[model samples]
Target chain A: MLINHPLLGPRDAAEFTCFGDASLLLRPDPGPNGEPDQAAMDAFHDYLHLRDNPAGTHQELWYHEQGDRSWLVVTRDTINHSIIKVELARNVKARNLKTREGAG
Target chain B: MRYSVFSILNQALRGNTGWKPVWREPEPRPAYDIIIVGGGGHGLATAYYLSNVYGITNVAVLEKGYLGSGNIGRNTTIIRSNYLLDGNEPFYEMSLKLWEGLEQDFNYNAMVSQRGVLNLYHSDGQRDAYARRGNAMILNGADAELIDQDRVRAMYPFLDFDNGRFPIQGGLLQRRGGSVRHDGVAWGYARGADSRGVDIIQHCEVQGFIMEGGTCVGVETSRGPIRANRVGVAAAGSSSRVMEQAGMRLPIESHVLQAFVSEGLKPIIPGVITYGAGHFYISQSDKGGLVFGGDIDGYNSYAQRGNLPILEHVCEGGMALMPAIGKARMVRSWGGIMDMSMDGSPIIDRTPIDGLYLNAGWCYGGFKATPASGYCFAHLLATGEPHDNAAAYRLDRFRSGAVIDEKGSGAQPNLH
Candidate 1:
């Protein structure tokens, strides 16, 4: 699979280290409760371990280990192994954080 | 009908018309005492044990496709209990013992062969690790033997012993570990369960779970809504999707694992052999085809197919282990979806929803763990308590920091 890295252009999938499901980026925060309550702990556990492993359109994390030291979020259809979108994980994380902050 | 020589002779005399269907193709009942989604080997075995052992006969096993159409029939068919962890060794050893008596118990010719399984080591460190694993297996009342390169050469001299990259040093052998007819396991369990008055419903796709308050009462299937006092889900690859209908996310990812078979050849491989340097494992089937497989496709996917890169990687491991098999033509290849968990172990515990039990996260080891997985899952469903052998397979173990990390890969499902 040719994953078009955000920084390094198109690179073979062999050059990237595959970490499954870009949902992993949405880590649950330790809320303002001084100490984490039971609900926060459960939310954190789900954030860290739970996943939506769909057969079609999935966003996953891939690190360009051999090409460049950048983590890329690639949206691909797992059924036919087709790439749909590619972006820097840092940028995606920042954009998501900004959106959440703006909403808050 | 009892399948004996006399029955065969009687059927032969009567022009073979006395034989009956192995299992009834029943329609889904409106209600059942228990409903088991996914009629694969594990689900069928669970039904069999529930009816026979626990006397819970009012069970229905719903299948989306035909029996054994999932990973149960798609694996390499090797069975071994050579594990290093206290959490896995006893369970798999129980499975191996159950496999030994499976045909007798079910009255079917499932062909459970106990030709030894050997995991070769290429380095001294790897050998040490295998030694530790063998000791653990022995401590768990399972048989394990450590042998040097000479003994391996005596067993199979065709291996690439002199290869500088991964020279064969030693191996750990489990004498009782071997292969079984993969499809026969499902059929045997189905027949056994059917005889015990459990309904085996094929082509019944489960659409969603029926939740009453906080308890799972039944399922919405393609046939219609079927009520049940308890619901057990043994869906292999679609565990995440099926559980999601109940608004429960799983600590599991689905990945594709491919297996291959070569054209028929003379008897070459005497027993199952695993390459230590890489992930390839191979054994000669009864039909003379060399069945083999390697690692999973290094990505999360529910697709039941793999990429060419993993196929080439598996072939490279095969060539590195046995150079003679390089000339063998690959006749067929297929993929099975693996329900990989965070800690490389399984979960056979009650979910947060009352009366909802889960038996998933088998990953690549599901085929070998079939019998014991069914036994423990049935025990849990019958008594509402985790079986002693499967007490470590709690769903909240990840949160409790009590993960049974067999591979020690640290929360990486694909790596496991």
Candidate 2:
């Protein structure tokens, strides 16, 4: 599979390290009291471990170890393994946090 | 019917029409005391043990496809207990013991061959690690031996001894470790469970869980809704997706691991052999075909097929170890979905839902852990407590900093 690294252009999938679902970027926030409660801990645990594991069109984290060392969020169809989109993980995280903040 | 020489003779005399099906094809029942999703080897074995050992006869094993159509029939069939962790060694040892008497207990010829398994080390550090693993195996009541280069060369003289990248240094041998007929194991367990009054339901796809008041009461199947007092999800690759219906997220990811088999040739390999420097392992089947496999595809996927890069990587490892088999024709290749856990170990414990249990996260070792996994999972479902050997396989082990981490790969599911 050819993953288009945001900084390194197109690169082979073997050069990157896979870290599973991109939902990991949306880390759970602290509780209302600014300290972790049971609900917050449970949500944090779920965020860190649980996954969608979809069969198609999955967003995943891939680190370009041999290239620019940038973590890329690669959207690919797992069934056919065709790349859809690639963006820097930091940009995705920032955009998602902003969107959530605006909605909240 | 008992399968003996007398029965064979009687069937021959009667034109071979008196034989019965090994297991009955039953329809889904309205309710059961215990419902086991996924009628693969582990699920069938769980049902068998629950009915026979725990006296829980009102059980149903629901399978989406035919029995043994999953990883139970798609593995490399290597069974060994050569582990270095306290949390894993005893459990695998118990599984190996169960494999020893499995044929007799199930009344089936699973071809439990005890030819042995040898892991070849390529460096001093790998040799030291093997020695540590061997000592742990011995401490766990499993047989292990550390052999020098001379012994390995004497046994298998066809190896590429002159390779510069990976020298032939030594190996770790487990004499009791071997292979079993993978499909026969599933069939035997299904038959055993069927004869013990458990319903073996095929073509029953579980779409979702039937939850009432935060407790899983049953399952919503493609056939219909079926009620159960307790439900155990042993679906190997689909564990995360299956549990998602119950509003539970798992610390697991599905990745594809491929296996290959060459055309039938002369029996060159006597036992299982693994390369220490790489992820390749090979063993000659009874049909004379060389069965081999390597690492996973390194990506989260639910597809039961692999790309060509892993195939090339695996073959390169094979050529590096034994150059003579380079010309062998690879006839078939397939992939099985592995539930890679965060710590490279399994989780067989109660879920947050009151009536639901889990038996998943068997990365690449599910086939080897079939019998004991079933035994322990059955014990847990019956008594509502973890089994002695599986007490460490809790759902919250990662949070509690008690991760088994047999590979010491940390929390990276793909790395594990």
Candidate 3:
């Protein structure tokens, strides 16, 4: 009888390729349903300050699932599926912090 | 093809849209009886065992991402019960038993193979260690056969068995030790648990934990807050981070570990070969790729991707033993994060915090310990007491210089 390969997992298992930064990468495959979920853009805006930028590096690829489970935005090349920069998909100022900072 | 971090960084610098979150709508839930923190193998299995065996329903396995997307999915899929620690020995051995009956238990074929595992030795001292381990295994009723060079050749002739460098002395053979279908283990648990009223909540992240009078009442999640009588943390790679959110400390270091698989080939390695002399081990995935891995990152890292040096060292050790492997093309490689404790043995005990329990510190052997760990952890949850065997793995042990040093290293590797 023929045996299947080890890497061949179930159909829905998230496929991943590793670059620099982070463990447990679980970013979802984009949906075919047309509209993108723009609800988490602010999360992508100020991720560098949250991630604190890796040593000697400025911009980083941060998929928020490591613990935040918020949103992770990464910049990549269209030609090659490479993660150039990653950040938390959500980066809203905390309500208390926003009030404390006198944003009003 | 998926995007690489390098090109993603380039695009980000050029005002290009890169790494962004794909958010899905949140699903509604009233409340769950038992809520498992991380939806890895142990979490899922606990849910299955909780509902199937204990008859307790209304369970929810909350995963920050899709199921089997964490360390459970990233592991090398090697399963063995060759641990030398107390409680750990019997515990892992029991997991091997559950693996033996998993197809019947979960009604899913996990593809468990008892193809045997050989721990190689280079020097007499190394050979002596295997003897001790082998003797221990025999004493514990495990099937361990000490084989000589001739015996090794008879079993596997393709191995470079001659007067080459790093000469092969002998090996400690665990005839029953082998591998299993890893992701299958995940799905089997998911299906079994789902069928028994266990709601597996995916794309849900647990934010800070909810503490009531120093007892963990429940958790505050990204979706919302959840209340539970008890909570378990089987979050392998994210153990430290998850615990941190609960206002606790864990004696664990997160490190990156990588596994590589070569292109398909004719049969070469018939069984799992562990090079005890170095951080090297290789096994042929049924798909024909030589799946192998090595030590954790020397430095602390939560990053799943490993450095080049470790990948080089692991492959070097493989090439040293199996020279024919030099021509084999490396098809793919990936890495996973591990919450490595000071000692390799895991900690399965109730914390000072009431109703909150920890089953972390799995090191590199989490896959092998899944069933036994889940059973024991479930017992801890139900009775609020650590089993007699697992009681020794307490947080205070790390403080009072009390430890069960199985490998006797007090800390990390050099475990045969």
Best by DockQ: 1
Give the TM-score ranking, best first: 1, 2, 3
Candidate 1 TM-score, C-alpha based: 0.97
Q: Candidate 2: misplaced stretches above 4 Å?
A: A4-10, A27-43, B410-416
Per-residue alpha-carbon lDDT of candidate 3 for residues B1-416, written as tens digits (9 for 90 to 100): 12356766888897876644322233626466677889898898888888877777776778999989988898888777776656567777778888888877887668899999999888899888788887777666677888998999888787777636688888989989999889989888787777676788898898877888887888889889888888887888687678877766566655567889999987778899987657788999898888888876443455567657667778888877777888999988887767666666688888778878888877777888788777777777767787665667776566555666775432232232
TM-score of candidate 2 versus the correct structure, residues matched by position: 0.95
Pairwise TM-score winner, candidates 1 and 2: 1
Second chain TM-score, each model: 0.98, 0.98, 0.90
lDDT of 1 by residue, B20-84 (tens): 89999888889999999999989999999999899999999999998888988889898999988
Error of 3 at A36 (Å): 60
Residues B1-416 of candidate 2: C-alpha lDDT, one tens digit per residue: 76788998999999999888988887888999999999998999999999989999999999999899999999999899998899999999999999999999988889999999999998899999999999999999999999999999988999987689899898999999999999999999999999999999999999999999999999999999999999999999989888888877788878889999999999899999998888899999999999999999888777789888899999999999999779899999999989888888999999989999999999989998999999999999999999999999998887887999688653363453
Which of the two, 1 or 3, has more TM-score?
Answer: 1
Model 3, position B308: C-alpha lDDT score: 70
- Ten-residue segment with the worst summed lDDT in candidate 2 chain B? B407-416
DockQ of each: 0.64, 0.61, 0.02
DockQ measured for candidate 1: 0.64
lDDT of 2: 0.91
Q: Provide the lDDT at A42 for model 3.
A: 25
